[model samples]
Target: MTDTTTARKPPTSKNSEVHVKKRRLPDETGIFIVLVAVLLVFSILSPNFRTIDNGFTLLVNGTVIGFLALGQTFVLLTGGIDLSTGANIAMSGVLVALVMQAGVPWPAAMLIALIAATSLGVLNGLLIHYVRIPPFIATFSTQGVALAIPLIITGANSIQVRDIGFSWIGQGRIAGVPLPVLLLLVAAVIAGLWLRMTRQGVHVYALGGNKNAARLAGVNIARTTILVYAISGFCGGMGGMIVTSRLMVGFPATGTGNELFYSIAAAVVGGISLFGGVGTVLGAMIGAVLIAAVSNGMNVLSVQSYWQSLVIGVIILVGVSFDTLRRSRAGRPVFAKRPAVDTPSLPPSTTPSKS
Candidate 1:
């Protein structure tokens, strides 16, 4: 009998293999170049911008918001938006403060805060997935819930966190890095791996690329969408806790209107499409870093606080405009490349063709 198995062929063309490899480096390098240019421009503009102290300070101050933006990355990748992140942050802080004040141990208080935040996420997932409410509407409603809970609990006052040990997660630094920054790194790594390597990652991309196609391909669209929003809420809660710790207090009015930037700016700058399906963890981080740099540079230059908002708004508008232009030039879907179509094996000729 003839052997049925055939030898697997290696990629024959070096050019094809090299072309495949070349793609990996460029996605991030473009962003990196832009970041470097921004840094260079600002350093030249302000002597204080290049100082190590200023850099560390920027990292410390923006760490919590940056972490929240990472979660926003996940939701945005799946073509969903989470408007509730700012609210979640406030609510989580309030929940943590209340538990601690109620004589709960610091660890227990922390756990309670996480649970409260995650519960809010779960609720967002339920509304979006089960109720079939649009993501924008669902998250917007949850945003109200997140904001309201904090006000109800704290009554518009800031609650001080007296336990130093409990505050360490937000305030403590190891080996010269801020604890919040470390947490941000950890969150980024975890998110990056999930979005890059796992089956769920592929599913998320597929869902964003084409919901009907994902469903036809047996990807669980509902589950993935729910999970992404849940993650967004979790990040908000964690960010809230960190901010509370850093300030040593949970203020009800904190993070108001800040969610717009955290969710919108980071994602947009990081190359996450407003229409969804294309983004990366590193890109999101870079975007957050860019925003942080701009804000920090403004501070170093002694620009008025009002001007800071206007600058940030202008940056966002420009970023969005760039993305629009890029999309228009391409004039096709961003991730449209695919493997070659397979040809069916020919059946044995029962009768010779009369060519």
Candidate 2:
């Protein structure tokens, strides 16, 4: 005779197995692919769009937007926006020219203008952090001030830049590449590295991700806010300088055009979420290139300016709408959710019967 016995197996714990999700490609990847596709399409559509010279022109034209978008990336990462960027450009350009016209060296004038523009950024920070003002109200109020200051100072007239050396910033080329494009590339690399490698950069992300959580994590909210806005201001100053240099004149109307829209659109399109805490500088740069290409391509095809504006407007809506949808669903699937790692089920175990 034999007795049969069976042993029951213990329940498997969910924590026993680790689910390491596959590494995601950088957020910039999709945008980069899109950019490549755009370039290809435009190249096919117009022979003018395929020329190396036109390629350089695209980069040169996009430089100002790229600079503004870089700064906007920092600000957006902190869940803030600066509508004053365009105005800051006008202000800094006018101030630098006015200073140079007043017998100051161009370099010195540029420095002063940068300082002034940066100070405005600091003001935005102070108001938002200490004064308890909303980012929109704060930046919009300052935008009006910035726009008016340049107009008021210049008496609504353009200021001529007599210093030929200053033109190098915008017009000069090295190794056949435009100076502005090179400067933008260098700045983008540094900005990307800083965001990925620095402590403050992490804080910027944390703040944007969840402000109260970031605060509890010992992130200095005030400083991060101020720093981002200040960066935005500095970028604006750089844009102003480049444009002023290119034109050899500081016009109050310089950045008052579609620049502000293009920069914001570029930032959002490049993968910087409008809801914040989800973007990269590299992505923003890609977006800038895409925007520049679209604009340039339109011009190559002789599309009207109004049509260009309409296309940009549509792009902005699409980008922001997608961002908003993502934020609303946070960690859940909206359009396409973050890919999930499948956890395999464990088979049941049993002891052999004794006979």
User: lDDT score of model 1?
Assistant: 0.77
Could you tell me the TM-score of candidate 2? Answer: 0.85
Once model 1 is optimally superposed onto the true structure by TM-score, how far is the C-alpha of residue 185 displaced, in angstroms? 0.8
C-alpha lDDT score of every prediction, in listed order: 0.77, 0.85
Which tens-of-lDDT digit does each residue in 1-355 have in candidate 1?
9766977777589898878755534344445556677789889999888999888888877776687778888887777888888888888888888888888988888888887887887788888779988889998998887788778877788898888887788778799888888888888998899878898987777777777667767787778887887787788878888888878898887778655665578667777766667778888888788778877888888888778768777766666565555555546455442211122345678556889
Please estimate how well model 2 matches the true structure, expressed as its whole-model Cα lDDT.
0.85
Best by lDDT: 2
Give lDDT tens digits, candidate 2, residues 150-182. Answer: 888878999999988889999999998999999
For each candidate in turn, the TM-score is 0.85, 0.85
> Once superposed on the true structure, which residue ranges of model 2 sit more than 4 Å away at CA?
1-21, 315-355
Clashing pairs in 2: none
